[model samples]
Target: MLARLTIFVLILMLLAIGWKAWAYRKSALSALRKVEVISERFTRTDFFEEDNRRWIDSGERPDVVFMGASITSRWNPEGKLGDLAVAQRGVGGQWPSHYLLRFRSDVVDLHPRAVVFKACAITFRPGVNDKGTRRAILDLTAEAEEAGIKPVLATCVPVREDGNTVYGSDGKKLPDGINDRMLPFNDWLRTLAAERGYPVIDFYRAMADDRGFLPADLAVDDIHPNDRGYEVMTATAKPILETLLGAGRG
Candidate 1:
């Protein structure tokens, strides 16, 4: 009788907590829509434009290069894979779809021995604009392979689904869930990588909870990850990326 009572009370507590979260989601999403509107002012610049000016000026390219958005920019594989020379060139708010468009100049020109591409979660809609994004990554990897550069593709990290206002209206945010569009893009990349014979880094599984959402602590806002999240990404990516770079050395 005591155990059952305890369980019942716990269940009630959980329900109360869940209800509160649901209640606040509308407000959080309302704020998000406003930010998205303002964020448009920050045009997608070169991934290595700002703080990493030294990396370009140093004229010393690493054996491996990591490129993507804020996630990759903040990734420091120090201590764990410090011996493996790697350059980080991440642009905040960049989508793979955008990265592909500038692949030749930003990545291919660098001529690193290997490139670790941290493919962020679906920023494109599959069966619509995503085909182009997929092709761009594929084309860039093919170019890398032809140039004898290893390309390591990483699975996108899971993000909070409730707050994305991309598919919503003006003042009122829509009920955009995880299965909306990004999931399909991720699926496409995974299958496409297999067919194209590229090594993949499955970062999603490491960060996602059982219900398939990024744990609240791992991410700071919605898609952007905090330091701890990057730590998890670096841990999952180091081994596979190292092996790919090692093979190039031999």
Candidate 2:
């Protein structure tokens, strides 16, 4: 009886948290809508392109490079990937197409021993489909290979379906359909990695719950993860990075 009561109370508490989060919904929605607007009107190719060129021309070779969208942009693995020179080439709200466009300037020119491409979480965005995302990644990887950079892939972190205002679990079937698209992307990447004998770091499994949602505790809102979530992400990614770099060196 006590255990059941505890479970019941916990559920109630979560519901309450969800309710409180609802109050902030409109603002978050506005911010996200603005992001999508910006994405549609802009390309971030100019954001840090010249900086990467300077680094390359200076002859400073980073040991590893990470490329992706917001998550990759926000991740600071310098301390976690310790002692190894790391490069971050993440652009906020970018999709695979954006990354592909800037690949040579941001990544290949860096002459990284390996590149870890973190998939973005825009599988639900309009005009963006799973097949396109898949193709972009494949194109990026192929380009990386032709440039002689080791291509390492990573799955995106989970989304807190309830925490995010965009698709919160507000008495609705919330984010399932959006995330339904996510699963296939992940599955395809994993299968492709295995088939090609490439390294894949599974950040999705690290931050996801049994039911596949980003556990509320690990996420900040809906799509972005909190420090604890990124902590796990970095930990999960480190060994794979180590192995990839090690193998590439030999």
Q: 1-250, model 1: which lDDT tens digit per residue?
A: 9999999999999999999998899889999998766554443444355434554577755677776877776677755664676667666666665566555556666667778777665453222356666776777677778877888777777776554445434455445444455566667768877987777888887888786677788888777678788788778877786676653332
Worst 10 residues of 2 by lDDT: 163-172
Candidate 2 lDDT tens digits, 1-250: 9999999999999999998898679779999999977764565866776778778778888888888888888888886765678888888877887788778877887888888888767655545767778888889889989999989989877677653323443544444455677777889889989987889999988888998889878877788888888899889988888776652332
lDDT of 2: 0.79
- Give the number of colliding residue pairs in candidate 1: 0
Q: Which prediction has the highest TM-score against the true structure? A: 2
| lDDT of predicted model 1 | 0.68
Candidate 1 accuracy as TM-score: 0.68
Please give the clash total of every predicted structure, in order.
0, 0
| Residue pairs whose backbone atoms clash in candidate 2 | none
TM-scores for all candidates? 0.68, 0.76
